[model samples]
Every structure is written in structure tokens, then in C-alpha cells.
Target: MSRKRKETEVFSLSFLDCICCGFGAVLLLFVLTASRKADQMDDLQSKIMAVIGDMEYEISLKDKEIERKKATLAVETRLAKDSGARLDETKKRRTELEDMLKLLLQQLAAIEGELGKLIDEKENMPTQEEKVPIPIPNPDRRQYLTGFDILGNQVLFLVEASGGMTADTLVDAAEWADKPEKERREAPKWKRVKKALKWMIANLKEGSNYKIIFFNKELVPLEVGFGRDWFDPMDPDLTVEVLNAIDDITPEGGANLEKAFAIVNELPIEPDRLVLICDGLPTLSDSYAGGGNQVMYDDRVAMLRAAQNALKLNLPVNTIMYPLMPDPGSAVHYWRLANSSDGSMISPSEGWPDI
Candidate 1:
């Protein structure tokens, strides 16, 4: 037994070497895995840092944009406030100007009133010599001269008794045209026309022979059937009759100056002067054969020119024009006619011949 124990060994060299090699291999694997993990952590940390840096830059840019918007808002607010102030100033200036205009109008009205009073005083003043005394029927009544010589031995008055004479405007005339004859005769314009005729009759020169022919589509003498006779202005009965007849007449139909002037040819004596009392130019003529209910402006003018040719005698034409709406050309034409005929054209004031 002693001899067998002496030769036996507890461990061998190959087994120890195997154990050491296994330990070395495990250590190497651990070192390699640790190095790879450390490298991956470093890369992740770098990516995280770059992301944070970019987010911080974006936030800074947003802050700068907010500041710029705030600045723009401030500038716009300032401009709006300035514009509002200027608008208020402009409104205030406009108000002041309007007030000034109103004040000026008032002053002008006052001045005009004073001027009217002065004119009235001058007209009412007594004259030393009475060459052609303009007779005032009433002492309190005011009368105005026609501003032309009305001195003629034989005077003829051609009054237009057209529908237009019933009113100042065409619309009103149309309205009145459909009214009753009595109502039409009582129209304000018609009454004024009657007053004008009465005033002229009252102011006629002493010993003068006068004839009145009222014409529309037809010619009508003051006294029917006396179209060719002249009445003495001094005959009080005839004057009253003539006035009464004029008052009774109702204005109707269109004005026919051609027919009216043709009546002059039928007169026993040629008139020394012709007084035309009308609102506007003739709307009807014998020469116009055109078939239409309405008469155009140009047609009316042509009718007037044609009517002038009907006058055989070259007597002075004194026109006393009353206002008619849309008759602008009438004034110029009448004025030219008067100028050419060495006569006067008067558009009397509303208060003239204050009956």
C-alpha cells in the first residue's frame, strides 16, 4: 500500500492550463462588450445634445418673430390714432365752413331786402312832370313800368290764353287743365295774367285806340264778333267790359301764334305797336301738318319763326313773358326779337302790378 501512494498526484498541468485559458477568454469577451456599450452611449449622448441645441435655436427665432409682430402692432396703432385725430379735425373744419356759409347767406338776404326797399322807395317817389303817368288804380297799390315806350295811338294786345297760362309750371298746367272751367279761371297764374292785362289797360296812354285778341288754337276777341274793331281806351264801359270778359275766360288749348298774327291782317287799322303777352313760344301753327299730340321743342321754335313771317307789318313787338318751366330758350328768343324790333322784353317780378 505504501509503495502505490508515493507515485500518485493530486492535480495535472494540462487541467490547470485549461482552467486558466477559460478564465482569460471570459475576461476578453467581457472587455469587448463593455467597450461596445460605452461607444453606443457616447453616440446617443451626442445625438441628444444636437437635438436640444436645435430646439433651443427654434425657440430663439420664435421669440424674435414675436418681438417683430409686437413692434408692427405698435406702429399700426400709432397710425390709426393719428388718422382718427385728422378725421375729427376735418369734420370740425367742415362744420365751421357750413356755419360760415349760412351766415353769409343771411347777410346776403338782409342786403337784398334793403335793396328791395330802396327800389320800392324810388318807384313810389313823385315825379315833377307826368309825361306818361302810370295810373295806379289803388293808392296803396304798386305798379311797375314795362321799361319801354308804350306810347302809341293804335296798340294791339295779343294775349295767349293757352293751357299753359293756367299755371306757372307745365305739370301744374296739366293738373289744372283737367279741372273745372271755373277752377281753371281762378288759378293763381291765370289771375295774375288777368291782373297784368288790367294793369296795362289802366296804364294805357290817353286817347289811344287799343284792341285785345285772346288766342289759343282759335282767335277770340274780348268782345265776340268785334275782332276787326278797335276800342277806345278812354271808354270806361268798354274797359270794364273787356276786363270782365278777360276775367271770365278760362285758359285752354295750345297757343297758335300764326293764327293770332293772322288776325292782324283782318283788323281795320294796322296797329302801331304789338304787345305779346305769353308764357312761351307757340306750340301750334297752321303750317305744321305733322300728326302728333305732343309738340317738340324744335318744332315749337320753327312754328315761332313761321309765325313771325305771318306778321305783315314790321311793328315793334313788346313781349311780356311769364315764367314757364322747361322754356329756357323762350327768353333768349324773345329778347332777340325785342332787340331786333326796337322793343322791350320784360319778365316781370312776382310782385309787379301789385293789384
Candidate 2:
């Protein structure tokens, strides 16, 4: 028993010391490893946080760009709408101008129609005044009288200068052998014819054109040459010269009526009116008369031919017939000629040119 007690306790001190030392070394190693792991985890967490911050900054920049684009689009839309409104206004103004143009054209047409109507009315109105006498002053104190509307632009006076004009009456033979040449020239009938011609010259309208054709065997101009046709607004001195020329003419030739009408036809411009002064029918025509004293049937035929020429001319032949004592036939034939030509025939009475 003593020997077993001296052997050792169940828990030996050296074994316990070894166990404690091992346990302390294991605890110290665990603490150092844990520290190193903590440091590595901190580094990984910092890198993740930096990456997330950069992504958030990029998103913010994208959002600002979208807002700027939206504002630009809105401004462009407003400008487009304003332009469309202006275009519509311009179209409306153009339409209004076109309408105004149409209205102006209608007004002009109406005014033209009114002017045409007024002109027609003026042309259609009838005048009451019968005679419009020329207002020229008569220095000879002679009467102013005319049956015709002698207001033509061109007028012709045809005076017959024949041996018969020297007679006391148109039909009676003149006593030319018994009387002196001066006395024969101053015969009352011939004097009256000259006076009438002078009166006509004096009474011519101011600014009127005229011509004198003294017809006997041929047509002869009073003052002007054969080439000259008319005298426009004859001067007083020229008129006096013409009258003197007529006075100097001696009545001797046979009255050739055919030549007178033929001359009228030959004129380049036809006279508007013809004033024919004669005492008898035509004595000489295309040929000589068969007998002297009276107009024969052949002479009448010749006169008829002359009248036909006048008719074809269609110019008004105003006749101033000095009464023939024996040949009432002459008056009747002249009346027929005047009627055919739509002319006027006036036989002077006691008050001669006044009638």
C-alpha cells in the first residue's frame, strides 16, 4: 500500500502544463489570422462603393441631356405654328385683292355703257331751227337769203354765161345789134344775175371753202387757174378779184350743160352741193345745135343725158332758174331734174334772192 501511494496522482502536473501551453499557442494563432481577414474585407468594400458612385454620376448627365432636347423640340413646334398662321393670313389678303379687281372692272364697264347711251341720245335728238344763216357781215347792205342748207364743207357755184343772158327775157332775143356793147352788158336781167352772184359771195359762211365755175362752151374758173380746184376761206381781196373776173366775162358762147356735168365728174373730189344758175335748157351739148332759137327734141335728149350724169353723181344740184318767157318746158324739165336728184329748185319772184 505504501509503495502504491508513492506511485503518482491520477492528474499529473507535467501533462497538465503541456496541455495549457498548447491551448495558449492555438488561441494566439487564431487571433492573428482573424485580424488579416478583417483588413482584406475593408479593401473590397471600398472598391464596390467607388464603382456605384461613378454609375450614379453618368445617369445624372443623361437625364440633363434629355431635358435640353425636350426644350429645343418645343421651341421648333411653336415657330412652325406661327409660320402656318402667317401663310393663312397672306392667302386671305390675296383673295381680297382679287375681289377688289373684279369690282373695279365692273364699274369701268358700267361707265362706258353710260357714255355710249349719252352719245346715242345726243345723235337722236331733233332740232327745231329751220335755217342757220351765216353770221358774216354784209358790206354791200345786200339781203342774206338761202333756201338750201349751204353749210357744206365744199360748195360749187355754176353760173351760165351765154348770149341768151344778154336778152331782156330768157326767151326773147336780145337787140344786141341796135344797142351798144356796154348797154347790152348792163342789161337788167344779166345785172340781176350778177347781183345775185355777188350777194352769194358776200353771204358765204366764214371759214367755208368755195369755188366758182362759169360754164358756157366750157367750164372756166373765175379767179384761180384750171389746176386749182377750190378756195378755202377766200380773202376779201381774192373775192373781189373773182367778182371782177366774172364781170369782165362777155356773154357770147352757147351754154354747154354737158361740159358742166362732165367737169363735175372729172373733179378729183366731188362737190357736196351744186348751185346751177341758168335761164334756159342746154343749147350746145356733145355736138352743135341743129337750129338756134329754141331747144329741139335732140337738145332735150342731150339735157336728159346731162341730168342722168348728175343723177349718177348723186350730188344735190340746187337750181336758180331765171324765168324764160316762152319756154315753160325748160322750167318743167329743170323741176324734173331737181326732183330726180333730190335737189331744190327756186324761181325768184319780185323779191328775187330773198325768196
TM-score of each: 0.58, 0.52
Find the 10 residues in a row with the least total lDDT in model 1. Answer: 137-146
Indicate which candidate wins on TM-score.
1
- Where is model 2 more than 4 Å wrong at Cα? 1-146, 168-172, 177-181, 224-229, 287-298, 310-312
**What tens-digit string does per-residue lDDT give for candidate 1 at 136-240?**
774311212337545688989999999999888999999999999999999988888888877677667898988888999998887723543477766654554
Q: Top lDDT: which candidate number?
A: 1
Candidate 1 lDDT (Cα, 0 to 1) = 0.81
**RMSD, candidate 2, Å:** 31.8
TM-score of 1: 0.58
Q: Which stretches of candidate 1 lie over 4 Å from their true place?
A: 1-146, 224-228, 290-293
